[model samples]
Target: MSDRTQEMEEQVAYLHKTVEELSDVIAKQDMELRALTQRVDLLIRREADRQSEAPGAAIFGDERPPHY
Candidate 1:
């Protein structure tokens, strides 16, 4: 084979390997983002339930007026 043809083949192989590595990295990041989104959703739901059950408890905490 000619030197030119061999050089082109090597370049193509290197590009293919690099593309595969980048694809795996993107897949891992996507999975992590999905898990984080689920956790945030659960926390939001829990807070909403607490607020409904306690009514004004959050606004009054454990403080007292000056005549306590």
Candidate 2:
């Protein structure tokens, strides 16, 4: 094979390897994002349940005046 043809083949192989590496990185990040989202959802539901269970509890920043 000619030198130019060999060079082209090597470049193609390098590009293919780079693409595969980037794809793997993206997949790992996607999985982490999904896990974080689920955790946040669970925390929100837990807070809502706590508030529902205490109907008359004084919420943050809603305290009565000291004189009262």
Candidate 3:
């Protein structure tokens, strides 16, 4: 192959490798984001349940502390 053709092929190969690496990073980040979202949802539900089960015992998020 001509030098020009070989250089273009190498460039294309490099781009493909870079794209694959970026795709893997994106996939990993997506999985982590999903896991974090699930954790947040669980915490929200747990806190709501706790508040409901002890309506007067729990301090409201917006309310000041008794010492204040």
Candidate 4:
């Protein structure tokens, strides 16, 4: 095979490897993002529940509004 043909093949192989590595990284990040989303949803629901349990509840234990 000619040297030019061999060089092109090597470049193609390198590009393929890079693409695979990037795909794996993207997959890992996607999983982490999903987990974080679920956690945020749970926290929001918990806070809503706490608020519903006590109307006008103070965030810092009886810390009323400045206007009050």
CA RMSD, predictions in order: 7.1, 5.6, 3.2, 4.6
Ranking of predictions according to TM-score? 4, 3, 2, 1
lDDT of 1 by residue, 1-68 (tens): 99999999999999999999999999999999999999999998887777769856653434586698
**Residue 54 displacement in candidate 4 (angstroms):** 1.5
**Which residue pairs of candidate 1 clash?**
none
Q: Which candidate is the best by lDDT?
A: 3
Measured against the true structure, the TM-scores of the candidates, in listed sequence, are: 0.72, 0.74, 0.78, 0.79
How accurate locally, in lDDT, is each candidate?
0.85, 0.89, 0.91, 0.89
* Model 3, span 1-68: residue lDDT tens: 99999999999999999999999999999999999999999998898788889956854855898899
Candidates in descending lDDT order: 3, 2, 4, 1
Candidate 3 deviant stretches above 4 angstroms: 57-68
TM-score of 1: 0.72
lDDT of 3 at 6: 100
Clashes of each: 0, 0, 0, 0
Name the lDDT value of residue 48 in candidate 2: 74
